[model samples]
Target: MGAVRETLDAVRLVDHHCHGTVAADLGRDAFESLLTEGEAWPGISPFDSPAGVAVRRHCAPLLDLPRHTPAEEYLARRSELGRREVQRRFLRAAGTDVFCVDTGYAPDPLTTPREIAEAAGGTSYEVVRLEGVAESVQTAGVEPDAYADTFRTAALEAVRRPGVVAVKSVAAYRTGFDLDPARPSEVEVTEAARRWFARGGRLDDPVLVRHLLWTAVDLGLPLQLHTGFGDSDIRLHRADPARLTDWLHLTAGTIPVLLLHCWPYQRQAAYLAAVFERVYLDVGLTLHHVGPARAGGVLAEALEITPFRKLLYSSDAYGVAEFFHLGALAFRQGLAELLQGRVDADELSLPDALRIARWTGRDNALRVYRLEADGPEDD
Candidate 1:
């Protein structure tokens, strides 16, 4: 316990994937609403769940309250401090030095990457969502025949933007990973664009989705794929990272493919990370939702077959700063407990345990995301 605490406490985390905190102060209902991926119930409260409980247990102390503070009291204290102060406290407490922010999820007002970096006293980079950029191109009215080139140019331009370090895709939510693994032909993409444009709605066209994904692959940047469990939009069976095996084989060695928030399929995700050189996995949103105690078990499963270098840390936390703090806390506590147990049992030496801890907490992400020597700026 002593060794584990010392090693983990000294490590600064690179939150490889997460979203910005909401810009405005939240009411109790508003705050609780962000706690779960599911729809809010008419009478039931979000605080009845594991993540809510974890927040009370862990994040309460950061807010200057006792551990296990009641949700009512917690929200009141948060409201009194105002949003900026709350963000400042949680982000700083997380011990995260860098944030790789995905700025595409919700329409809710949120702090920009620059703002989050300011709040956390860290540096931040952007992950351009492939789907979001494609939708924007579509909305801007591209001719069906020109959609492919237009999208290609737009995506390339986006990746070249200052601070844009990677790309992301929500294909798991849109068309799933069961699509044809081969890149679509220009004719096929044009036809798909025609169909999508004719339908006149959000880009759910399966063919176009495939086109978007393949384009991301060609961009040669780390691509974060939303896999496993998520909000109601995800089809559980289709969201499995293993479904992308065919695609993985096709895109192998091309770019880093990160599977995010893999919960039930974490073992499967671990298997992929084990077999595929470019594959990596992170149990971010899942960690805080499962709470600190159970987070060890989840991290253990993810680590079982995964190469130590293939696993990265992320919060997948959106709309709230409590998640940033809780995600880091859960990962630190869980990884420490697991590695420390191995050291105690003589399965791993102290030096090896400390090395593994540092690799998972910081070095792995730094190398994967190419953040080496790109340290955060002083606030």
Candidate 2:
């Protein structure tokens, strides 16, 4: 195969699945510095749903509750200042127009039934939503089966607000992943899954996966599922892409499934993508954990194996803004470098780049969330 050279627009790129909420918590200055340092950083954002917001509110306290007094539990809590700060930083660094938010996992905050995301004219921050695979059951104490109803209602209510674009779902963890092998099992493994299942989870049952997929179709939403190695508590093999066969079989003909971070099983995930019409994949954990040195190879593999249109970008950006922004930049540039100079690089040609850039980012999101055409405009 001949090497293919592709040019790119000045905009850099879009990161489909970043947790800007955590980055936003890092404060504005740190966020700005990180973006300024990383030239390739395209966009930064998060799900920022009610569960996300609650996570923002309670993370510190949750961590400190054990050491601190119960009464002072609320004192360690911080704010979502990082969300606004990330916006400010993105505007300053990339000038990109959108930052897709993950709203499916969160219920509508009590203060507002749905606060549609809005972008300021010429401002870098525009809140976009990816609905589905909500955390309502885990966060709001709702039943597992009711996830569909709660998610559909919340999505309808939120999408009506404009900036809402798509629905994103997750099935990777009841607890968090332990990336560092040194500190393992600090988090209870099956217990978290049990907690999640107690509310409304059925990871072992193929029927549950089908039910979730049907719920996506019923709501006419695109689903983004977490598939790859995750926190220590999660069974690594359970996160395999093969287990999603039932889901793939059910939705292959209709609803779009944006597979999020099929890391250890990247090849398997890409194979699945090739076979499924509606199956697309994004690079989240790969970018965050793989780093720039290896990201190029990973991107090349994804581009070579999956159709360009089926490929998407994401930061899976987490922690503080600076760290997240750097991770995002590493991914965008890594992809460009891997696909730009090679003649056989059909995967990263300028056209494919644009498709992955513009269409894959929010357009795919729109199609998945059923927010296309008649959905509300930006808030």
Candidate 3:
């Protein structure tokens, strides 16, 4: 058990799914808004939440404050440090070796992929977003007949970007997973594209969204899909990964499907990972939101039936550098405790526990994205 704990502490993580941090300083209002999955109401501070407390206890020290510093003082210290140094400190503290960043959603100014890589002293790779490409095609005025082909071509080009390791979709935010599993015919896609262009807003039409996913499959890169838990945009019940069963069946053996942030549905995700050879999952955003205290419980549920090889580590950190620090802290602490307990109980051998810790924290992601070759074993 002691050996297991020591190994996880030293294992450099590969954050397989995350977003870039901001490039500029944030006022209290802007900063608080990024802290939660919902809007900050008139009176309540995001500082009162689990994530907030975690930051104060875990991340405050990195900014040169005592643990559990008051929120007001914490914010003041952050503003005093300025932006670049803040990012550098937090990214370095995370001790991550590689970052697979999703460059899709940036409501605020964010560090670019290269900037993030530089700040952390690690490699950074891109995960292209599927819907952003389709929306761009619409904004660029493609003819209805050309929409399907144009989107497919654009997506193909997007993945060819030098650092792109994979592609992602926020269909969970748009239409949910009850979508029909079958691919739309060319005619259906053309008509759906025509309606979408006329409606002229987000690309939410069910048919077109499915087309985007299938296009992801055709591109043959590993595809990441937002699963349970997100901002107000997600319809909680509809976002369940179980609803994706048929779609998974239809696309089986086509490409790897990585489920992101499956909380509350971590069990469902674990079930899927048990059955689907190409399916993988991570409880990323969920960890930061639950904070360090509950990270072990959440991780235990995610690993209950999940194959060790099918689980990967992610921060899903966006906008806030505190999350980069907190997420890594929570993962290392929680995963270490859980695996060490198994070793103590004699449920797993010392060697097996160490292997699982290494796989979940780093090696699994490296293999999933094919960043580099790893030995073939599921220890």
Candidate 2 ranges beyond 4 A from true positions: 1-6, 22-87, 104-161, 174-210, 344-379
- Candidate 3: residue 191 lDDT (0-100): 96
Candidate 2: worst 10 consecutive residues by lDDT? 107-116
Q: Which residues of candidate 1, in runs, are more than 4 Å off?
A: 373-379
Q: Candidate 1, after superposition: displacement of residue 215 in Å?
A: 0.4
Per-residue lDDT of model 2, residues 1-379, tens digit only: 2121122224434444544333224333332332221222235322122222222332323233332233223222223333444433532343233344453332212111122122212211223232223433345555544544565575556545655444554445531222221211313333433455665543432333333345555555465677775545566676777666764664557667777888777887788888888888877766645555566777767666786567776655443333334345456566656656552545345555555555544465444444433333332
Per-residue CA lDDT of model 1 for 43-81, tens digit only, reads: 998999999898899898888999989999999999988
**lDDT, model 1, position 215:** 92
Better of 2 and 3 by lDDT: 3
lDDT on C-alpha atoms for all candidate structures: 0.90, 0.47, 0.90
Error of 1 at 245 (Å): 0.8
Model 3, residue 372: distance off in Å is 3.9
What are the per-residue Cα lDDT tens digits for candidate 3 across 1-379? 3787789889989999989888789888888988998999999999899998888888899989999999889989999999889999999999887888899987777888778778888888889999999999999998999999899888989888888889999999999998998999999999998899889999899999999989899999999999999988889899999999999999988899999999889999999999999999999999999998999999999999999999999999999888888889889888988988998898999899999999999999898899842212110
Better of 2 and 3 by TM-score: 3
lDDT of predicted model 3: 0.90
* lDDT rank order: 3, 1, 2
After TM-score superposition, the amount by which residue 206's alpha carbon in candidate 1 deviates from its true location, in angstroms, is 1.5
